[model samples]
Target: MTFSHDGLRDSLTMLAAPPYFYENLRRELATAERNRSRFTLIRFQLFPRDEQASLASEESQYELAILSFAEVLKTSVRAEDLCARLGRFEFTVILKAPSAVAESLTSRVVTSWSSHQEWSKTALCKSAIVTAKIGESSLEILNRLDNQELIGITQS
Candidate 1:
């Protein structure tokens, strides 16, 4: 896959950009179709803690929380897995692994991130995991996944 420098990576987190994420998702879908393989997509949303009103006013702190969470994601998944920043407080991972493995990793990541003393107090993460179907487009899968309630770190 070609990686264009422009919009290839998020400037704040240095993770894959939205365009890159979508492209990779499409490619992974095709690869799964061809090889009859399975892959899982994990979506993450980070929100400031309800009691942490100051976090919203402090831009630097908010950015640092995002950056730190991104680092945790980068370190948690395999190098071949695609990790992308979908929005200001959203991220995704394309894991070329079975649903079980994906689920385990998701739990592990949430645990690790929540236990971090620095940013955990300011923000909390909610995540959802969906495995790709045989005959589905990237958008279709994403839409379905989006409808599901993202499980919070404590809930996971």
Candidate 2:
């Protein structure tokens, strides 16, 4: 699919933008349906622990924390996996793997992000994982994942 430069990727994180992400998600869903294969979708969100104090005064730092967390995500997944930025503080990863493997990868990502000195202090990370089901559309899968209560990860 054709997309403007900005439409294809998020400027700050250099990850796929929503249009590109959804297009790929649709393609993946179709493939999974046809082949009876499974793939995992993980949604991640970052929120300031103390919004007023952290975001109001440390806007730049908050942005830097997002950038760092994005890097953590990028490095944690396989090269073939699709990583995308869904919103200012939201991201998603599409892994062509079974649910168990996806959960392991999710733990790695969470641990790496939480261990980061700056990122952990600046933002709280949360994630939800879902596996594509037979006959489900991309929107349906995404809606289910989004509706699920996110699992939060914080620094110890």
TM-score of each: 0.91, 0.91
Q: Compose the digit string of candidate 2's lDDT tens values, residues 25-121.
A: 9999999999999999998888777757645366678778778988998898888899998877788999999989888988898899878866787
Off by over 4 Å in 2: 1-5, 51-57
Model 2 residue 122 CA deviation in Å: 1.0
* Pairs of residues at least 3 apart in sequence or in different chains that clash in candidate 1: none
Tell me the lDDT of model 2 at 5.
33
Q: Residue 27's C-alpha lDDT in candidate 2?
A: 93
Q: What TM-score would candidate 1 get against the native?
A: 0.91
